[model samples]
Target: MCLLAMSNSLLQSAKKVILTEAQAVMMLADGLDQSFIDACQLIQNCTGKVVLIGMGKSGHIAGKIAATFASTGTPAFAVHPGEAGHGDLGMITQEDVVIAISYSGESDEIMTLIPIIKRLGILIIGMTKNVNSSIGRISNVHLDVSVEKEACPHNLAPTSSTTVALVMGDTLAISLLINKGFSVDDFARSHPSGTLGRRLLTLVSTIMKIGDDIPIVSADTKLLDALLIMSQKTLGMVLITNNNNILKGIFTDGDLRRVLETYPNIQSLTISKVMTPNCQSISKDRPAMAAVQMMDEFNLNSLPVVDDNNQVVGAINTHTLMQAKII
Candidate 1:
C-alpha cells in the first residue's frame, strides 16, 4: 500500500510539472520582439546550411531544431560544442550560419568555439535567456528565449527555458518554410517512411482492387447475380457498368440491407431498379490520402475507382486504406 501511494504521488507531481510548463508556454506571446524578426531574417537570407551548436539540454533541443529545419526545406546539422573544439569544427564552412544555444549564454565549451566560428567568416545566431550576456553581445543576431521561471520545483532544472527555446527554433523553421514556399508534398517527401508520407504519397491505384478481384456487374444484371458477384469477389460491393464498361451505379451491403427491408424480395429485383445512381467515385491517380478524406467526408466504407474516361477499373475499401496506413 505504501509503494502504491508513493507511485501515485510521483505521478501527480509529474502532472503538475507538465501543467506549469504549459502555462509558461502560454505566456510566450508577449515576449515576441524585433530580435525574433532579426533571427528569422538572418536564417532566411542564409545561402549555406545552418549549423546548430549547444551543450547538455540545449544540445538536445538544437538537434531537434536541426532536424526540423532539414525536413522543412532548409539544410541544417547539429554540431556539439565540445566536439567542435576537437575535430567536428571542420564541418563548419565559411558559407554556413551557426546557431549557438545557451540558456545563460555562459557555457565555456560553447564560448570557446565562437572565435573559431567567427574567424571562418560564418554568421552566428545566438539563442539565450540573457540578451546582455557575452554570447548575445557577440552574435550577429540574438534571439531571446527567456522564461519567467523553471517548471522544476527547485527552480534549477532547465524546463520552461528549454520549452521557450524549442518554440523559438520551431518558429524560425516554419517561417523559413513559408518563405521558401515549401508544401505538404515536400514535407511528405522528407518523411516518406512516416504516417504523413503514407497518407500523402500512396496513390489510389496502389491500393485499389483490379482485374478479377473487382466485383463488376452489368446495369441490367439481376440483384441476385450482383450479390453472387459481390460474394465471389469478396469485396462487400459490386460496380454496375453499361455496355461500354462505364460505371453507372454501385450496390453495397448497406444498400442491399435497406432494399431488403422494403422489398423483402430484393433477390428477385433488378439492380437498375434499386441501385444508387451517380454515386461518388475516386480517380485511380488520386492520392490515397485524398480518398481517405473523401471517404470521411462522405461517410463511406468503400469507393469505386474510375479512370479519366469514367470506366470502373478497380475498387477500394476502408480495410485496404487502413492496411496501407492511409488513415
Candidate 2:
C-alpha cells in the first residue's frame, strides 16, 4: 500500500475503535435492568469490603473497578482468580460481596474458583457477555456487558468488551456511592494524599495561624499600630476586633493603599476609620477549599476564621494554603 493509503487506513481504524467502544457503552446503558439495582443493593448493604476477581484483560478492568469502588466510599480490593486457587480465597467473607468479571463468563481460572467463593456464602456479582454462562447462572446478580463485535478486525482482542465492562464497573461504583450518601469529604478521606483529597479534606485549622501569630488589633488602635501588626504578621492584613474579642472589621494592605490615595490625613485616623466594616470571615472547621473559593471570588489574600459565637479563633492566608498544598 502507498504511504497515503496506510495513513488513511490507520485513521479509519482509530475511528472505528472509538465508535465501537462508544456504541458498546450506549448498548450497555440500554440493557441495564433490575439486576443492576440488585447489584447496587448488595454492595450498599455489604458489611465488609467488595472483592473483585477476574483473569487477563478482565483482571485489569477489575483492578480499576476496585480502585473506583474504594475511592467512592465502597471499600473494595481486587484479587486475581488464579491466585485464589493458591489460597487468596480466604480474603473473602460471608458478609462481603464478590464481583467477578469475564468477557466469556467462563474463563477456566475464574470458573475453577467459583465454588470456593460460593461455599463461603459470599454474594456474587458477575459481569460478563453471556447471562447464561456458568458464573452468571449462579450469581446473585448478573450484569451483561455483551458487545456485538470487538474493535479488532479479527474480533479476537478484548476491545469493546473490556470497555463496556469498565463502564459497567464505574456505573456500579458511582451508584453505590450515591446510595450511601457519600460526600466529597468522604471521598477525600479515602484519598487524603491526592489533589482532590487535599482540597476537600484539608481543614482551615490545619493551615490557619493561631495564638500570638494572628494579626489582631482593636478598632480604637491607630492606623500606624495596625500597619505594624500587619508587617509583623506578614499576612498583609490586620484583624480589628473589640476588646471582648468580637471581630468588627478588617484593614488590609489594599485598604491602606486606598486610604493613602483617598485620604490626605492618614496619620491622624483611627484603625476603624480606615478599616473595611463587616468583612467576610470563614469558620475554622470549614475546608481549605472553601477558603480558596472565597478568596478567589473576593480577590482576598487572607481571611479571619471565626467560631459559632463569631469570635476570631484563627487566621488563614493564601500563602499558608499554598504551602500546605491545600489550595
Candidate 3:
C-alpha cells in the first residue's frame, strides 16, 4: 500500500476507536440509577477501604479504579482474584466493601472468591456488562458498564468496555468526593510535592527571600545607591523605608525607568522622591498562592512582606513564586 493510503487507514481506525469509546462512556452515564447511589452509600458507610478484585483486563481497570477512589477521599485498593485463593483474601473484612469487576460477571477466580467474601459478611458491589451473571446475582449492588460493541475492529479486545468501566468508576469516586466535601487542601495533603500542594499549602514565609538578601533602602537614599542595592540583591525592586524599618514606599525597575525618562539628572533623585506610596503588601502567614493572585491582579512581579507594624521583613517576586511552584 502507498504511504498516503496506510496513513488514511490508521487515522480512520483511531477515529473509530475514539467514537466507539465515547459512545460507551455516554451509555455508562445514562445507565446510572439508584443502584449507583446504593453502591456509593455502601462504600461510604464501610469502616474500612474498598477492596477491589478482578481478573485479566478487568483487573487492570480495577487497579486504576482503586487508585481513583483512594486519591479522591474514598479509600480503596485492588486485590487480584487469583491471589485471593493464595490467601490474599485476608486483606478484606466485614468492615470493608468488595468491588468485583468482570465484563461477563463470571470470571472463575472472582466467582471462587465471592463465597469467601460473603462468608465474611462483606458487602459486594459488582461492576460488569452482564446484569444476570453470577457476580451480579450475588452482589448487594450491581453497576452496569455494558457497551454495544468493542472499539477493536474484531470486537474481541476489551476496548470500549474498559473505557465505560473507568468512567463509571470515576462517577462513583467523584460522587463520594462531593458528598464528603473534599477540599483542595485535603487533596493537597495527599500530594505535598505536587504543584497543587505547593500552591495551596505553601505559606509566604516559607518561600519569601529573607535576611540581607531582601532589597531594602532608606527613603532618603540616593537613586544611585538604591539602584546599587537593587542590582546587588538582583530582585529588580527595592523597598523604600524609614530608619525605623517601616515601609514608606516601593521603587521598582519600572519606577526607575519612568524617573530616568522624566528627570534630567537621575543621580540627584532620592528613592522617596520617585517611589510608589502605599504599595500592596502581604503578611507572612498568608498562603503563597495569595501573593500570586495579587501579582496577577496588579501586574506586579514582586511584593513586600511586612509584620503587624508595617515593617518590611521579607520580599517575594514572580521568580520566588515559580521556584516554590505556586504560580
Candidate 4:
C-alpha cells in the first residue's frame, strides 16, 4: 500500500510539472509583440549566419535552437559564452546576427564579449525576462521570454523558463522559415539522411531494379518458366512484355495462387493467359515514395517502372522500398 501511494505521488508530481510548463508556454505566446518581429527582421536581413550564445542550461537550449534554424533554412550555430570570451568570438562576423540567451539577462561571460561584438558592428538580439537587464539593454532587439514561475517544486530549477525560451526559439525559426518561402525540398537538402529527405529526394529510377535484374518474360513464355524467373529475381512478380520490351501485362504470386485453384495443368499454360493485363505501373521519374503510396493504394506488393511510352525500364517491390528506407 505504501508503494502504491509513492507511485501515485510520483505520477502527480510529473503531471503537475507538465501542466505548469504548458501554462507558462501559453503565457509566453500571449506576450508576443513587436520585439519578436524586430528580432526576426534583424535575422532575416542579415548577410551572414545566425550565432546563438548562452550560459549553462541556457547554453544547451541555445544549441538546440541553432540546430533547428540550420535544418529549417537559416544558417546558424551555437557558441558558448565562455568560449567566445577566449578566441571563439572571432567566429562572429559583422554580417552575422547574434542571439544571446540569458534568463537572468546578466551572464558575465556573455557581457564580457558584448563590447567586442559591438565593436564589430554585429547586431544583438537578446532573449530574457528583463528588458532592463545588462544583456537586454545592449541588445538591438529584446524578446521577453518571462514566465510566472518555474515548474520545480522549490520554484527554482530552470523548468518553465527553459521551456518558454525553447518555444520562443522555435517560434522565431518557423516564422523565418515561412517568411523565406522555404520548401520541403529545401529542408530535405539540409537533412539528406533523415526519413523526410529519403522520401522527397529519392527517385524511383535510382532504386528500381534494372536490366536483367527485372523479372521479364515474353507473353508466350510458359507460366512455369515465368515462375522460375520470378524465383531468380526474388521480386515476387514478373512482367510480360513484347519483343520491343513494351509491357503487356504483369503476373504476381497472388495470381499464381488463384491460377493453381483454377487450372489443373498450369505448366503448359502461356503467361499471357493468366497475367493481369493493364496493371498499374509507375514512371521512373517519380519519387520513390510515390511508388510506395501507389502500392498501398492498390494493395500491391510490387510495381513495374516504365518510360513515357510505357516501355519497361525497371521494377520495384516491397523489398526495394524497405531497402531504401522509404517506408
- Compare the candidates by lDDT and give the number of the best one: 4
- Which prediction has more favorable lDDT, 1 or 2? 2
Please give the lDDT score for candidate 1.
0.89
TM-score for predicted model 4 compared with the true structure: 0.88
Question: Every model's Cα RMSD, please?
Answer: 1.9, 2.7, 2.2, 2.6
> Alpha carbon lDDT of residue 284, candidate 1?
91
Model 1, TM vs. native: 0.94
lDDT of 4 by residue, 1-327 (tens): 699999999999999999999999999989999888998999999999999999999999999999999999999999998988888988889999999999999999899999999999999999999999999899999999989999998998999999999999999999999999998779879988778788889999999999989999999999999999999999999999999999999999999999999999887899999999999999999989889999999999999999988899999999999999998
Give the Cα error of residue 110 in candidate 1, in Å. 1.4
lDDT of each: 0.89, 0.90, 0.90, 0.94
Off by over 4 Å in 2: 1-16, 194-197
List candidate 4 segments past 4 Å from native: 193-202, 220-222, 258-270, 285-287, 325-327
Per-residue lDDT of 269 in model 1: 84
Q: Pick the candidate with the highest TM-score.
A: 1
Clashing pairs in 2: none
lDDT of 3 at 222: 92
Cα lDDT tens digits for candidate 3, 1-327: 999999999999899999999988887778789999999899899999999888999899999999989988888999998888998888887899999999999999999888778988999999988889999999899999889999998999999998888888888999999999998778877777767667889999999989999999887899899999999998889998888899888989888779878999887888888999999999999989889899999999899999999999999999898887777
- Note the residue pairs that clash in candidate 3: none
In order of appearance, the predictions have TM-scores of 0.94, 0.88, 0.91, 0.88
lDDT of 1 by residue, 1-327 (tens): 699999999999999888878877777667778877888888888888999998999999999999999999999999999988999999889989999999999989999998888898889999998878989988998888887789888999999999988988898999889987999889888988877778878999999999999998997899998899999987789999998889999999899889878996665688999888999999999989888889899988899999889999999998888888887
